[model samples]
Target chain A: MASLIACPHCGPRPKEEFTVRGDAGITRPAPDAGEDAWYAYVYLRDNPRGRHREHWHHTSGCRRWLVVERDTMTHTIYTVADASAEGETA
Target chain B: MADFALLHRPALADAKSGSFGAPSTVKRITLAALPEGHVLHVLAARGSGDLQGLIPRIGDGTPHAARPYGPGQWFVIGDAPLSSAEIFGKTPILDGKASISDQGHGRVRIGINGAAVETVLAKGTAVDLALSNFPVGHSAMTLIGHISALLSRTGKESFELLVLRGFAESLWDELIQMSLEFGVDAHTGK
Candidate 1:
């Protein structure tokens, strides 16, 4: 496989330079949260017909965050951005 | 970007300003090369305040669109580097506990610019690429064909597409074919 990839956090990189984490948007239940909550976090999914968020790890590349959007049914990706780039203000 | 090294400059400068700024002058910049191992020490956040004003104060400040990720989360584009530090200084940050390593996995980045950018994207992407909803600055991640990538719209006719190393060549070919209708010129590196 190729080695360099664009840093999901940064941008434009080689594949060998990064690692692929699994899908994004994995939620965990709180310690006191009930089994219903845990079950929903693990098993249930919204699987919307429109935009969907997922996670990817650029393990080998620059250590930054990434948030991706793709169609739930079509698997078509629309865009990618630094998960941390969210502005601090309203 | 005939030279790969030139592509190191942010996509915003290329699309919006058309002139690259001095690397040292760049604020909120990430000045590290590709590391080895899987590095996951990343801190991400979203701001609910005036995105319009905050855009210029940080890095490039160019107006790019944004998108939703997870619950109550959005992936936006700005001149700021994605780190634990604060830029907007008003928005709240959400942190992840997972440990990430600096594994040098191969990757490649390509920018799609042209009036038909959305149309080209729609060829392989499933999301609605309408300008009204998916306007500039908006971003998201998902699979394009078999490749998992990060896509960000940095301008009205421009976007940044991040494809994994393993699928770089394949995705590049696909992008070339898709971009043919709009006339694309991709620069791998500076």
Candidate 2:
């Protein structure tokens, strides 16, 4: 149960409206990068047990994509931000 | 409507006189189709134009509610369909590069009334519907079941919901089911 996530626009709502978009910190490999880089970028992932940053889509409401920082094990959402403009509001 | 022989049928074509519970029950929740209205999805963001000028204040001295479901975005609803270009004809905004999309036919609006309306809504949505919290003229985007729904409180005991055209029937069914525990009075017309 993902409880509630506060959407900067619609306020706190049930998480059902969102579809987790996965880790937000990963950078895509360069187009010219070798196969090893592409392999790592596409296959490798750090399953951090503690604090994690991920992207979530508010599919049902504002349709705004957001980045959420949370404690993986505790499922405590520390903060959120607009995915399109990470430096701005959550 | 992209060319086939589109059937002019209402979503709930077979709702029948199927109503559950009695009007004398604890509280009555009435669900019905709202009078036809126009909806505009306004994307008036950081670089967008001043949307405040588009939706004017009504006779009550209160401005018509612009539902801001996203940051810097609003959905302006009116009794008659009003397109952005039609409303703003020759005038153009230099500041706000606001984008407006007409959702007149792509969305469905339903009205929920009666004293038990709040109770029925509370069963699915998390927003506080208390009179002090979500009073009349208040509107917010929230989910009812898995569907994204824009809830606007029209009165103390009445609310209107806007959802995608495809999900109207499902949402309507869900609302009726939720109202079952309480009391639901269904009718074909207002």
Candidate 3:
């Protein structure tokens, strides 16, 4: 069986309860920035190999958004935090 | 009052009795609807300092006793009308803390008890429901045949499942199919 993500609100639950939104930590360009920046923001993505930060929604459990730190190579979850608290997102 | 919608759900329109399995095998499993009652969601912000002062001896206890829901929340299930507002108004309730909402109408509760209930549940959920892992009074939000549900063990051999109203009948049917071999003692309020 795969590892479970310990939800801060619902305790340790299977990964199925969450839906990974996308890579976290990407900053949006300021409104006046060129179209190239917007293109990168919308389409381009870094498929990094390790120590990736991501955003996931606990759709089935607490219904809270979470920021998850995971390793892509091994699928190991480092930590999970409530998105509303940290106020950080990609 | 206990007119909470959590007490009932619309029955499956085309359920065929005795199709899954006959209730001939008895004593192995028992299923019933717990009494009708209101269910509320009381959430204390995670890391919010104190919950003690919030209830502050509501005559004896907060109208309905609370049960495990999430890390910062409790399900105030009761036979009486919800009293979450009386004790804690829209104010902060002390600090920038705690919130409560009536979940009665949006969810439905079903009780499953007897020896083989775990066996029936294990068919669907991956989480271990063994007594050693999930003892009495323990609760967790999990999936039951693909539907998100709150699973609470109320006694040595009893469990209460809270599922969204939309998925109640589907879960009920799936549970029945799973309990076919063990036999289900069907009760009211499906």
Candidate 4:
């Protein structure tokens, strides 16, 4: 199908050219962190039902890292940016 | 073969021809078939060293170009329409099940050439629209004026932009505006 997708770094592009990276705002726990943190980093996910963050790469264009805030239930995208606020919480 | 042959312009059946705008302005628009040729299907494997794995086999080996697309997917851009087996024969990483299809998508393609092409592009795109990162023979999917298009570096100061049919008119208008500052001209082709 010919679908239109927007790059968080570069902007809008054909869905064919850009590859979906995955859920965004995921941060790997420090190597020296506790087992609980490591487990969360490795297996746990927020999987929010509402608006969530995703990471995507402009595989065909800018090749920059991007963070996209979108609603999981609906395909409505709210914001696209370079950095996510995931780290600030910690 | 011909240098122009390197371009695979999908075959157009019953194409409607018209003046895009002004003198020296024309665009060949239609649904076309993918050019039949020796298609080279290059599929790289996943992981840290996967990109590196493709370098030694590509001749003159370069690793940096293939990194942005990420791992685990195939990067199919070539002249030869060989099967995945053939590509794998050339490079071992192309072993993944490769899916191939004819050209059926409605794409509005434009070949832009001029000294100020980059300048015109820079006005719309947020990507590092520099010639170096996007050098000749390299391509990326980025947005121009917030409109997404596949930007392929066909030559020095020349690029092939593929945009959706819906966005064609708006993109064309944007192109016209951008080209005015750089002495823009267009030609129609299938």
Candidate 5:
């Protein structure tokens, strides 16, 4: 796990200050999109090995949702940006 | 009718007080519970830009009065309590750019100062307390040993922590424990 996350607003803080909301790349399916799509959206997730973008909430710091792009296998954080800045919802 | 009257009490009133830890003349820490005053949370409306100039009007004009913790968010604090009407009165100052939520009863402040204040505080938090990195008057909202508090540097050797009222006493005790190595004088009296 990435030990430190450089929050866009609060600077670099320990990972304990954040709450991971998982896969930021997934989009919510429409209400009438049918069962398979809704089920996949609700339950299915990609267990990617490297370079993942996820929604992380700065729970104890700025209280802002951030999109953290990092390597799952190496734990190297590539970039962290405010979720709202990219119009990305958590 | 209920016989119990709601008695207001400062959060740290019953917390630990007096000196403790090593007897050191060169590096001792002073810890005190600050006045239970006003704690107003200001949130900017969506698309509001550069509130830096407009937010201070709600503060008491003191140093670090407007402490920004995040984008479009600030905590306007003072040593004086404000009434509901008084708080609402300041709404117009933002000119519909922001809104204020009174948190006076929900949060408490703690003052800590000493020659080794930064060293003592670093034991719990991961923030870089160096003066060069966290200059005086800067504020950060972070966890100090699992407790979320707003840490603000008031001077080179002093800081003020704004914490939730319920956790005020607990954090005070933890602070005392952290400062034990340098000798601490905890004052909870109003």
Candidate 6:
């Protein structure tokens, strides 16, 4: 697991302060979308091994939603940005 | 009406006090429970731009009166208690750009100071407490040993912690434990 996350607002902090929400790429399906689409949107997720973007909440710090791009295997963080700034917060 | 009235009590009334750990003079840490003063939480209205210049208008004109913990959020503190009307009176200072919520009854301040204050705080938090990285008057909302608290630098060797009322004692204990090596004198009065 990534040991530290450089919060865009609070700077570098230990990962223990954040709560991971997993898979920032997923989008909410429209209410009228098909059942399969809704099911996939609600429950399906990709367990990628390489670079991935995930939603993490700085629960104990600045309390901001951040999008963290990092590698699952190497645990090297590539980028950390405010989720709202990227227009990606759900 | 109920038979009993709600009695107000200080958060750390029963907290641990006195000295502990290795005896030392140069590295001794002083832990004090600051006065139960007014703590006002301010939040910027949506789309409100930088309030760096306007927020101080609500402060009590004391040094470090306005402490910003996050973007668009701040805690205006003072040593004097305030009434609800007094708190609301400062609303117009923001001119509708921000709102204030009274946190006086919910939060409390703890003062810790010593030559090794940074070293003791470092054991619990990851923030760089060096004077260069965290200058005086800078505040950061971070976890200190699983407890959420706002840490603020006040002087070369002194720092203050603003924590929720329910967790003040726990954090106090943890702070003492962290300073055991340097010896600590805790005063949980007033």
Supply fnat for every model shown: 0.00, 0.88, 0.54, 0.27, 0.92, 0.81
The predicted structure with the larger TM-score, 4 or 5, is: 5
Error of 2 at B85 (Å): 7.5
| Model 5 ranges off by over 4 Å | B1-6
The chain B TM-scores of all candidates, as shown, are: 0.51, 0.78, 0.74, 0.54, 0.96, 0.96
Q: Report residue B77 deviation for candidate 5 (angstroms).
A: 0.7
Question: How do the residues B65-168 of candidate 4 rate in per-residue lDDT, one tens digit apiece?
Answer: 22223233323333334543554465434344232232223454555666666776777765455777777766566668767776666666666565654665
**What's the TM-score of every candidate structure?**
0.40, 0.82, 0.76, 0.46, 0.96, 0.96
Q: Model 6, range B1-190, lDDT digits (tens) per residue?
A: 5599767799998999999998999999999999998999999998899998888889989889899988899999999999888998999899999999999999999999999999999999999999999999999999999999999999999999999999999999999999999999999984
Where does candidate 4 stray beyond 4 Å?
Answer: A1-90, B1-93, B97-108, B165-169
List residue ranges in candidate 3 displaced over 4 A. A1-3, A8-11, A81-87, B1-27, B45-47, B50-64, B81-96
lDDT of 3 by residue, A12-70 (tens): 87888888888878888988899999999989999988888888888877777898888
Which window of 10 residues has the lowest lDDT sum in candidate 2 chain B? B55-64
Residues A1-90, candidate 6: write the lDDT tens digits. 999999999999999999999999988888999999999988889999999999999998888889999999999999999888997545
Q: What is the lDDT of residue A33 in candidate 2?
A: 97
Give per-candidate clash totals: 82, 7, 1, 14, 0, 0
Q: How does each model score on lDDT? A: 0.47, 0.73, 0.70, 0.52, 0.94, 0.94
Residue-level error in angstroms, candidate 4, position B78: 6.0
Cα lDDT of model 4 by residue, A1-90, tens digit: 224556644446555555666666666677899999998877776658878766766655655556667777777777766542333322
Who wins the DockQ comparison?
5
Query: Which 10 successive residues of model 2 chain A have the least lDDT summed?
Result: A81-90
Recovery fraction of native interface contacts for candidate 1: 0.00
lDDT score at residue B77, model 2, on the 0-100 scale = 68
Ranking of all candidate structures by their TM-score, best first: 5, 6, 2, 3, 4, 1
Q: Single out the weakest 10-residue window by summed lDDT for candidate 5 chain B.
A: B1-10
Superposed by TM-score, candidate 3 places the C-alpha of residue B5 at a distance from the truth, in angstroms, of: 15
Docking class of 1: incorrect
CAPRI-wise, candidate 3 is medium
DockQ of 6: 0.86
**Chain B in candidate 1 has what TM-score?**
0.51
